[model samples]
Target: MQFSANLGFLWKELSLPDAIRAAKAAGFHAVECHFPYDTPAAEVKAALEETGLKMLGLNTIPGDVAGGEFGLCALPGREVDARAAIDQAVAYAAEIGAGAIHVMAGKAKGVEAQKMFVSKLRYACKQAAPHGITILIEPLNTYDVPGYFMTTSDHAEQIIELVDEPNIKLMFDCYHMQLMQGDLSHAIERLLPKIGHIQFASVPDRGAPDHGEVNYAHIFKVIEGLGYKAPVGAEYKPTGSTEETLDWLKDYL
Candidate 1:
């Protein structure tokens, strides 16, 4: 039940080096990013080295470079695009020494799209395996990502099972699952073995722990009780200053 601050959004206010410094100063042992490719791998590595922070995770395929939307992996008819995206991710991960990569499922069309998506994932996993990196498939909530593929942990679990590789596992985001479904504890208990990574945000508002309905202390307790030692990603928006918002988590730690 270690904590990690997601540097994707909040860290934007600070330079990468300072962001890692701030996260470490704030009592976090590790940090994560959404798309570190936007920054150079050397800079990211340097920052991690300077701040004594572990690179917990980051996205393997972060969609288009220009559009800022639309992922390549889950697109219905884009195997080439998907492979290129995965290759870029593998290179980046190797360069920065990241542990896992969250493989986002792009927009879903129908049955054909899903089949293609699964095929692409299998390929990505094979490509990433040799790099000593694990591929994590996440399920986004439909409300936030309508028609987007991989909206359920059950679906993500099935995909991981189908991939049948030790390096491929589910990135179970508590916020998304709580929104898409309601049973947080049950889902975690059932899927803990298959989950290689975990993320969190307060439900209903996607804000810091205390600002939303989900009781993070209880959740942390459950996670700890289950003996899951992986870092729990703090992927939420701060309602106030990031420092102020994290007061609620101090007790749990």
Candidate 2:
């Protein structure tokens, strides 16, 4: 089982290039980020090349964060905006050679909302496919982002089915799953095929996985047993300094 440091959370103290190098130094097989739009894509690409590590994935731009747009994919009357975001993400992913892009659905619900989400996701999948990039839809727990559209693995699956796009897949985040519900092992087993990538953090508190309520060691074993070859995303916040907390990765390394 390989691992990717989520630079969005893991190495905030460093610039994009330095963060990529730090992740490589820490023995991560690959790296992922939330957003790289602010940093020049060429610079990030250079870092990835220098470190010889793959950039597994990144998130689509969250529209108007201050205006309460965590994601625009599921919002009503935002078709043009949503498509623009998708195009931007695709361009950025291509520039950096990222394999996947997580399309955020923001806080939306109900029948109309679901319909809009399906439409936006379909468009995203179609746009991303030609770039050879996979489109991921994650289910965020209410505890973290109340009213977020995708809140459970089943919810994500339902959306994926409705969208009916080959490029569409789930970004199965263990921290949110543990918060929204339990049964992580069974969920992973059943939803393995739909999952594009997986992320984890401490349950009840988004901290390092080592002290989490979830048994990561056993979970890692199950993932391996289930035959998932993709790198697991370490998308956790450090309880202390990020460097000092890496003792947990000694076994992984």
Candidate 3:
């Protein structure tokens, strides 16, 4: 039951390279991030090499964040922007030796959005295939990201099927799925085949896993029993300093 620190939430105060070192020092087996575009890939690669930590994955740039755009891939008339973001993410992931890229399907709905999402994902997969990088699509809970295009595991599965790309898979995030719908044990079993990566955070408040309604210990057992060998992503927000909230690590370690 190895763990990957999600630097996007774990070490907000440090640079990405420093965060990678911090994750290593904290004993995380690997590291991941939400966005690492601002940092030079060489520096990130150097840090990963120095720490000997695999970069599990990273997300595409959220389009127009200040204007409230969570993603662009599903938005109508944004094909150019969507594709550009995909290219950028894939290129960065390739340079940093990341295993996957989460192509965000921003706020949208209807058949057109689905069509757009599928098209963009197919494009993303094509670009990433050459680099052996997997494309991940996560179903974000609407409570935290209202109006998000992908909000249910079923919906994400449908999109994955539609894309029909072997390299594309679901980012089965436990926190969002539990918020949208409970039944974690069954969900993991049912979706295991399509899951490329799994992430966990305490439910209800999106904090450290120790206080969550979800019993991650049991969940981890279920996942391991199901033959998942990838390091599970620890993508929770710490309630205090990142180190202070690491008490939960003792249980998992």
Candidate 4:
């Protein structure tokens, strides 16, 4: 029942290095992030060294976020930018000793978009494989991200199969799955082999897991039963201070 604090949401107010320290002090076995590119990789590595916490993974930068583009890898005519983003993420992850990267698929649809996504993911896998980093594709819920290229577990699985790279894997986020699809326990069991990492947050409201409609206690038990030894990512927005929201950690365990 080990956990990884998702610095993107848990320690939103701190600098990335300080956030790493905070996660260590809070008893997280490891840490993961959405974006850590802003901080120098040397600084982040030093912090991880000081805290003795493994950096599980980080996401590729979403291109032109201010222009309403959540990601670029799936968008046609953006291969150059998308590959640049992947290169940046892989380099950063290598520098900080992270084991995986979540390659985001922007808002897009239709045949070309899917083709573009598969092509870019192949490139990403090629770039990451030598470094021993896994390429993760996550399915964002359409409710939270309208028209997002990926929205279902089945779709993600198909994309992974299409990519046909051993390094490619799924980033299964429980909150998004609960919104777009239910039957969490069964889905986990079915998708266990392809899953590289697992993340969770409260459903609908996207808050602490303690008050969620999803019974994380049962979910945690299921994960344990499945022999998932990797740290389960705590990717939730705090209902209050991050520290205050940790009662669920002890309760679930």
Candidate 5:
């Protein structure tokens, strides 16, 4: 149960290089990001080299560069755009030595839209395989992303099985799962084999680990018992400063 930090919200506070160092200082083994495509790969790679930190994962197809709401892969009818997005992610992952690409199944419209979305994901997964990167399909809750296509672990699992590829897997986000469905332990137990990545945040509020409803210590223990070796992503907004919020993880670290 190694830990990783998300750099999406930290960019305002730290430079890419400094963020990596800060994450290490705060006791994280790796760092994750939403979109690093805007930054030069050489520069990002240099930062990772200097910090001696690993790139846990990054989103391959983020939506609006400015609004940060849309991702290419689940745009219902934009398969071409989705492929291009996957290509960009593959290039960046190869350059940064990242192991996984977080695939967002954008807003869902209807059954037909979801079908199209799944097809697009399958194509994206195939495109990502040659780059030696695994794709992590995350299920966002309706409370945060109202119409997001992939909104449950079971939904993601269905797509993973349909794709039938070893490189494609689900990103079990504890916060989202807890919000959409309450059986966190059972969901994890059943999906452990197909999960390639995991993320955590307190439920109801998306705050730091100990501030909300989810029992992270027990969740971590369950994950450990299952023998998962991947880094667990800390994708939450601190109620205060990042440092102040991390106190909750002291016992585990």
Candidate 6:
């Protein structure tokens, strides 16, 4: 199975350009990031070209980190801000040749919130379509982000169904799904069509996959059996150094 070092986590110690180089050195065919806005698009593009690695995806900026706002797309009366956020990500993705964008739906509730999320996604999908970039919405466990709007694979599936946009898809993170709902094999079977991207780490403590409660070896087979060709993201916090903890993945690299 192909793997990706989620630069947001694996290479936090390096600069964005250096992180891309590190991922390539670590034997990753591609990479994804949380937020790459701080680094200029030109610089990021140059690094990818030099390393000959694909930047598979990136997340839209979470709104106002200092103010505790996780995302704006689903916030009431934040329509303008949310669309502007989408526009920025779309521009960056286009410039850097990224394949997808993760559209975050932060702290939201009720029917109105869902409606707003759908509206924002509709706009995102439209803007991203011409560039051939997929728009993804992940189900983050509330345990990690207390009020994150999308918190279950079912919830994301439901929202995607409601939006009914071809470009909009699920960013299914196994760690979050295992925490919120543990039936991963079955979940993968049922949601395969909607899954645009997948990520994993150890469950419970969110550490290296090798020490986790989840058996990633079996999970890797499961993913392959399901015909998922995209690189699986290693989105975990290291117990020690990022490179040292990767002994578990040495063979794959």
What TM-score, computed on C-alpha atoms, does each candidate reach? Answer: 0.94, 0.97, 0.99, 0.98, 0.93, 0.98
Q: lDDT by residue for model 6 over 1-253, one digit each (tens)? A: 8988898888798999999998898788899898999999999999999999889899888999788888889988999999999999999999999999998887888888899999999999999999999999998888889888889887888899988989998988999999999989889888998888889999889888997689988888999998989899989998777888887688675
Q: Estimate, for each residue in 1-253, the C-alpha lDDT of model 3 and write its tens digit.
A: 8899999999989999999999999989999999999999999999999999999999999999889999999999999999999999999999999999999999999999999999999999999999999999999998889999999999998999899999999999999999998999999999999999999999999998888699988999999999899999999988778999888787766
Q: All candidates' lDDT scores? A: 0.81, 0.90, 0.94, 0.94, 0.81, 0.90
RMSD to true structure for each model, in Å:
1.8, 1.0, 0.7, 0.9, 1.9, 0.9
Please list all clashing residue pairs in model 5, or write none if there are none. Answer: 63-70, 63-71
User: The CA-based lDDT of model 1 is what?
Assistant: 0.81
User: Worst ten-residue run, lDDT, model 1?
Assistant: 61-70
For model 1, the stretches where C-alpha displacement exceeds 4 angstroms are 64-68
User: Tens digit of lDDT per residue, candidate 2, span 145-248?
Assistant: 98888898888888889989899889989999998878899999999999999999988888888885899999999999999999999999886678887887
- For model 4, residues 1-253, the per-residue Cα lDDT tens digits are 8999999999899999999999988889999999898899999999999999999999999888888899989999998999999999999999999999999999999999999999999999999999999999999998888989999999999999999999999999999999999999999999999999999998879998877689988999999999999999999989779999998777534
TM-score of candidate 3 versus the correct structure, residues matched by position: 0.99
Error of 6 at 134 (Å): 0.3
| TM-score for candidate 1, residues paired by index | 0.94
What is the C-alpha local distance difference test score of candidate 3?
0.94
- Give me candidate 2's TM-score against the actual structure: 0.97
- Model 1, 1-253: lDDT tens per residue? 5888898856568877678888988888799988777788899899898888888778855566456445667776677877887888888888888888777778766777777777877887888888888988888888887767788887887787777778888888899999988788888999998988888888898988775778878888899999998778999888667887878668756
Q: Which pairs clash inside model 3?
A: none
**Model 5: lDDT of residue 141:** 87
